[model samples]
Target: MKHRFFPAVAALLAFGAAHAAPCPRDAPLPSGFERWAHPGLGVAAWQESGTYQATLPLGRAVTLHLPDIGTVHFIVPPGGKGSHGPYGGMIGIDVPSGATYRVMLSGRAWIDMVQDRADLPSSAHQHGPDCTGIAKIVSFPLHAGWHVLQISGAPDPTITVMMSSTP
Candidate 1:
């Protein structure tokens, strides 16, 4: 009986190994995506539901640092230039009541802050066109608890998002 059980277990293992899926080594990387790093900020990103998701700690000094909005090339002969931003994504966060946070954006962006409560109006911020390629800092207050931040705009390889608490 013991010998019979051993054979059955071995056969199951072999079957699973044969059916295992192989990693997609030749698959192309997603467009508008780039590796990013920030010291002491505890930041990370992942793809979900056809969009990118990023999260970071919002300390007492809440500050969000985003990378620039894509790349720009310039020519000196006829004086020409062009650039395309990366795809946008969503960021989910929770803020304590009566806390204020500052967002440091690095390019043109449309930021929308919303909560589940229908009574609350969504907070929106935009910086671009007139202020392209420039780093802008905007500080705002939150009512606390969970909130979903929908950040849409040009994709940026070096965009940073930092949220720090206000004094």
Candidate 2:
């Protein structure tokens, strides 16, 4: 089991690197958030530190740089389902529409993306050789509209979630 661990980690690292951009180290505030919060850009990157909700435009790719430690939960409303995942790496988001929104999550986590409140995610990526440090990229099809993105379950007192445009 241990022998294969090294190779597995290597593969995960490579996979993460390939999809590194589009998800930078800073999570952008909802367009004009400064008018109210006045926190400034990069100030509210972590999930626990500041503003956790942001509105993503249609067909924009963004990256949320997760903390180096702890578990994280990303919940999208309508279904109000939250995906519990591991710490570190980046989460890529490309929103063409809710039905075509793409979410790429790395590290240890459980993804339960459900379009309907009753139906569960068709698949899940668990922690292991292929999913170590980060899991596979999962896409969820939801309704077209502004969906509230929520984050939680960070072991650390504070953690940053970065968002950037994807190329």
Candidate 3:
């Protein structure tokens, strides 16, 4: 009987690969997290839900500092290596509390000389039109603890900062 219909089509493909539905678990990575390269006091933390991975050293130009807050920023451009920076860089943050944010980048962004550059303290700027600091396209808004993500240009890009969970 065709091997009993291949075991019922392999048990319906293992029940559709275990329901095949996730991503609601929320991302959260920040606890003894360590991935040193130039830890000259480098910061790459996440909470509310988490995921973190920062590895730099291909050309040399890395920066990630966000001690606490809602937090936001993500850039992963190494797919086929198109010379590197075609566009991807700019961030000025600071959010002590009341969290909420998201951002991911690869190409397309705006900012002059990287204003704020991760000093974010003037009451944690977040005042209109999505904070209005010039964040091309990615995802952003984070406050509560620290949020100082300042990624620039492209040299050793290994950006992957995912976070979701603020309830």
The prediction achieving the highest TM-score against the true structure is 1
lDDT of 2: 0.35
Can you tell me which runs of candidate 2 are displaced by over 4 Å? Answer: 1-53, 57-61, 65-98, 111-134, 150-167
- Score each candidate by Cα lDDT: 0.44, 0.35, 0.33
Give residue 138's error in model 1 in angstroms: 2.1
Angstrom error of the Cα, residue 81, model 2: value is 13
Candidate 1: clashing residue pairs, number: 22
Where model 1 places Cα greater than 4 Å from the true spot, the runs are 1-37, 40-53, 60-86, 117-134
Compose the digit string of candidate 1's lDDT tens values, residues 1-167.
99999999999999999988754654442221111122243222222221123454564212243333222111111111232344334455667666666554555555545456222332334342221222544556677776545444545534455455544
Quick one: best lDDT, which candidate? Answer: 1
lDDT leaderboard ranking? 1, 2, 3
User: Which runs in model 3 stand beyond 4 Å of their true positions?
Assistant: 18-87, 95-148, 151-167
TM agreement with the true structure for every prediction: 0.44, 0.32, 0.22
Candidate 2 vs 3: which has more lDDT: 2
For lDDT, candidate 1 versus 2, the one ahead is: 1
User: For residues 1-167, could you state the per-residue lDDT of candidate 2 as single tens digits?
Assistant: 99999999999999999986563334453442212222122221233223324333333333344454343333332222243333422122333444434333333233333322233353322221231222334444455433333333333333322222222
